[model samples]
Target: MPSSTQVQLVRRPRGWPTEEDFRTVSVELGDLAPGQVRVRNEFLSVDPYMRGRMNDGPSYAPPYALGETMTGAAVGRVEESTSDELPVGALVLHGLGWRDVTQADASAFRRVEEIPGGPSSLHLGLFGMPGLTAYAGLTAVAGLREGERVFVSGAAGAVGTAAGQIARLLGARTVIGSAGSAEKVALLTSRYGYDVALNYKEAPIREQLRAAAPEGIDVFFDNVGGDHLEAALDVLNPNGRAAVCGSISAYNDSAPKPGPDNLSRIVTRTLTLRGFLVGQHPDLADEYREAVTRWFAAGELAYDETVVDGVENAVTAFLSMLRGGNTGKMVVRV
Candidate 1:
């Protein structure tokens, strides 16, 4: 028998989650069943959507059960296996994260393909859920067109970074982005493909957005809601489309948060606003993977990860991501 340490949610967070809300527990793993596999996680993902899961209400995904181990995406190597599908030393991707070790039915894991020079941890970032979200939101939800001027809010985060680049690849004439910090604003242009970057903390977003895309924007990829949504609505060109992804701005609010005050513009400008969940659009998964694979191979795309070492620090890494402390994808190295 072996033991593994896992982070369990002991309390449902009210506003912001704290370390006290979680408890680390060591559990003994009895012998595996005939179809079971054991894995040692190499990396685990911490995402903005997890905040919604902390609540006690229903959403696309069920809330994290109190006193149960938290789950997310993880990449790891199978150490022991009783099934032919997964052998010892094979790399895999699974949804049993927030733990250093996992033992489950072999069917619960999927083998990760070798990417030649690319890091395997990317299975938790660029080539995984975040990347798929960006592609589906932009192309399918927003109906982004060629030569369109685009705006992306929260453009320094994982999905934002990918959305900006994907928009450029899809023939966006100009891509503008907004971030909370100066460093992230700089990275939007230097690293990501954004043509113009605005520091939302330094200026009124409406004023900055107007100046950045003076001609008006054709598409908006919204990650931050609240004022960002209102600002985009104010400046969107007639017939503009917006893909409403995550509203990270109000994720931590304990009470009901106000929405964009300028939503009337949607009717006046004949704008199209659509909210989406990646799970709802699995039809685009193969297309997204193929396009992103080509982009990565040709050096047309790049990704970043702000990694926190150790599974004990997963909670801190998650909190840091919520506060915009990470420039790109935030992951915990286990």
Candidate 2:
């Protein structure tokens, strides 16, 4: 038998979670049953959505139960296996969070490959769910067409970075992004090929968006909902499309903030706004992976990662991402 270190949810957090909400404890692993494999976790993901899970309420996914292991996506190495589909020493990625090791049914894990020198924490980011979310949300949901103007909020984070580059690849005539800082704005425009980038915190978002998308935006990839969504709604062209991804601006709020007063724009302009959960669109996964792989291979797309070391720092990374402290996908290396 082996023992694994795991982090369990000790309490449901009211606002932002703290270390007291979690408990790091050791668990003994019993003998693996048929179709089960033991995995030694290498890296784990700390994403904004996890915050929703920490609260005691119904969401797109189930909230984490008190006294249960805190759940998330993780990349690990198969230490032992009793299933034909999974072999010992194979690197895999799965939704196994905040633990040094895990034992899950083979079907719960997928082998992670093509990572030279083995996959780093980046696999759970750029080439994983976050990247897929951006790719699919833009093309499949937003109907991003060639020569259209695109605007993205939270444009320097994981999905935002990918969304901007993918929009460019899809022949968007102009790409604009808004981030928290001037440095991130520079990164979006200069490094990621966004035509116009604004620091939303320093200037009025509506005014900056007006300047950025002077012709009116054809597509708006929304990440921060409150004011950013309001700003985008005001500038949408007739028949414009908007993809509603994560709304981080409102994620930590204790009360609902007022949204776009101009939601009527959606009706009058015949604009479309669609919300998405990445798991709900599994039909687009293969296509997204193929397209992104080609773009990455050809140097047409790029990715960034902000990694915090160890499971103990997972909370820090999560908080940082919500505060726009990261330029791309935020990951934790265990």
Candidate 3:
């Protein structure tokens, strides 16, 4: 028998979640049943979407039921298995995260190619969901074209960093991004290849965006909503497109905030704003992964990760990531 240390939500968070809202529990695992596999996770992913799951409310995905182990994305190896489909020592990716070990029917896990001595955590960030989100947003949703001017809000996190670089690679004439800090602002320009990086905290995002793109933006990749969305709406050129991936700005808000003040621009300028989930766009995953692989192998793509050691620190990583403490993907090294 083996035991797995798992984090469970004891209570629904009121606004900003505290460590008290969760409890770490140790559970004994029985012998593997037929068709089952046990995985010792190498990394646990902490993402912005996890915040929405903490509350019992309507969301794209069902809310996390109280008392169950918190679930997201994790990559690891099959330590033991009864299913021939997943043999021991095989690398796998699954949704049973927040736990150092996971046991489930083999069907719940997806096989990913092994990167020898590579950080398995990359599956949770670049070349995975975050990268796919940027791809679908820019191509399928925003219809980005060559020489178009592009803007990305919250351009420091996993998806943001990917979005900025992808926009440039896709032939955008100018790539502009806004971040919450000076350091992130530097990363956007120096590493992520953004032509203009604005510190949103130092000035109004709409003012900064206007100044950066005096010619108006052709595409908007929005991760932060509220003022960021309003700012995009203010400067989007006619027939511009926006991929509304998230609204981290209002993730913890106790009440619904008002809609973007300049939403009328959508009608007046024929701008397109589409909200999407990466899971809903599997049609693009294969294409995204292929491009990422090629770009990375050719030394054309760049990424970063903020790693917090230990499974016990998963909650800390999640909270810190929500507060913009990480430059890229935030993962717990299990």
Candidate 3, residues 185-231: lDDT per residue as tens digits? 99999999999999999999889999889999999999999999999
> lDDT of all predictions, in order shown?
0.93, 0.86, 0.92
| Two-way TM-score contest, 1 vs 3, winner | 1
In candidate 3, how many clashes are counted?
0
User: What stretches of model 3 exceed 4 Å from their correct place?
Assistant: 116-118
lDDT tens digits, residues 164-226, model 1?
Answer: 999999999999999999899989999999999999999899889988888999999999998
Residue-wise lDDT of candidate 2 within 181-247, one digit each (tens)?
Answer: 8789889988887999999888889988987777899999988888899999989999999999988
Evaluate model 2: give its lDDT. 0.86
Q: TM-score winner between 2 and 3, please give it.
A: 3
Clashing pairs in 2: none
- Give the TM-scores of the predictions, in the order they appear: 0.98, 0.96, 0.98
Winner by TM-score: 1
User: Lowest summed lDDT over 10 consecutive residues: which window, candidate 2?
Assistant: 114-123
Give the clashing residue pairs of candidate 3, or none.
Answer: none
